[model samples]
Target: MAATELKAQARTGVGKGAARALRREGLIPAVIYGDKKPPLPVSISYNEALKRIYAGGFLSHVITLDVDGEKHKVIPRDYQLDPVKDKPLHVDFLRVGAGARINVQVAVHFVGEDKSPGIKRGGVLNIVHHTLELSCPADAIPEQVTVDLAGLDIGDPIHLDAVQLPTGVQLHGHEIDPTVATIVAPSGMRAEEAEAGAAESAAPAGETKE
Candidate 1:
């Protein structure tokens, strides 16, 4: 629940040219908007931004961004990346109030995987949803949703309801409970099953006296 402290420079100009100029200076333009307040333009280091973005759960992590002296508590709302080079172009942050609730996508982390019976039997663990969208308190958004895989069998399915979330976090996949993950038979197991089925089908219908 602790917020990360990040220092950023307040931007004076706002335009394509100004953004391009900041990029050339190793800074990426960003905006802080939301919570019924005016937008504040700022810029952060490109390398720092890229490092944090690739570090995992960038959007879900709360940040106490210091813009030239003023500080704002915010969460990343969206970002733009260069398609070709895959570099960060811009980032937008939503101002977070003490009691504000924000919808965020949280990464899924499975524990007890090594202890799963299915995994030990050479079954493949197929993940259906790597990240789950959740409505959580702005200051209490979970970094990741953990699912327990203990004692799971090859044919066992992991439903969304099985996932354990934080205290105040809310999940809205109500109409149809979705499967988060499942353990499936490996290719070798699948092939053996197929061959066994074929052999049974190929058995002669006519009885032969021995």
Candidate 2:
């Protein structure tokens, strides 16, 4: 994915009061931390950050941190939001280079409908896992990982190997058991069992139902 261009400025204050004050001014308080440079406190315009993030794959966007007119490469490592208000509260910017590898949570996206023979025959497709943890270069990170469930059967288990990752992406869940999807028989299938039982039922030699 292409990197998103964003603008940010260095901050001179710290603490809740300072952060609140920045918010009141319609700005988001953030920090930039990297290997060689000291962590720098910065602030970005609230409206600008919201717009970029809402567009999708905002975390992978390389930001230009204009700290007193000095630009630094950074990516959003973490962010906090107000639960009720759903507003951006604070953001953490980690200094990174184009070659650096970072571990991030990539969203899970469904590619095809659960067309398993069992599901078509009144079975249900249940998904137990959502996002997956991956290690990839920040530049090549994907917004989501697509999971294909087209050929699965009722008893078929979609495991981690079933998922297709981007060129350089690697899943951390590979070592552990991977269960992406499961097919379950629907409630109506129970009626079929009952009917089969009745068909096999027989009356005693001399005793018959009216």
Best by lDDT: 1
- Residue 23: error of model 2 in Å? 1.5
CA deviation > 4 Å runs, candidate 1: 173-175, 206-210
Q: Each candidate: what lDDT? A: 0.90, 0.77
lDDT of 2 by residue, 64-142 (tens): 6677777777778888888998788888888877588888777778755645576677667777777777888877878
Return the TM-score for candidate 2, rounded to 2 decimals. 0.79
Name the 10 consecutive residues with the lowest summed lDDT in model 2.
199-208
- What lDDT does model 1 reach? 0.90
C-alpha lDDT of residue 51 in model 1: 95
Question: Per-candidate TM vs. native?
Answer: 0.91, 0.79
Give one digit per residue, the lDDT tens place, for model 1 in 10-109: 9998999999999999999999998889999999999989999999788888999999889999988888999999899999998998798888888888
Minimum summed lDDT over a 10-residue window in model 1 is located at 169-178
After TM-score superposition, what is the CA distance of residue 50 in candidate 1 from its true location, in Å? Answer: 1.6
List runs of model 2 lying over 4 Å from the truth: 52-69, 173-175, 190-210
* 11 Cα displacement, candidate 1 (Å): 2.0
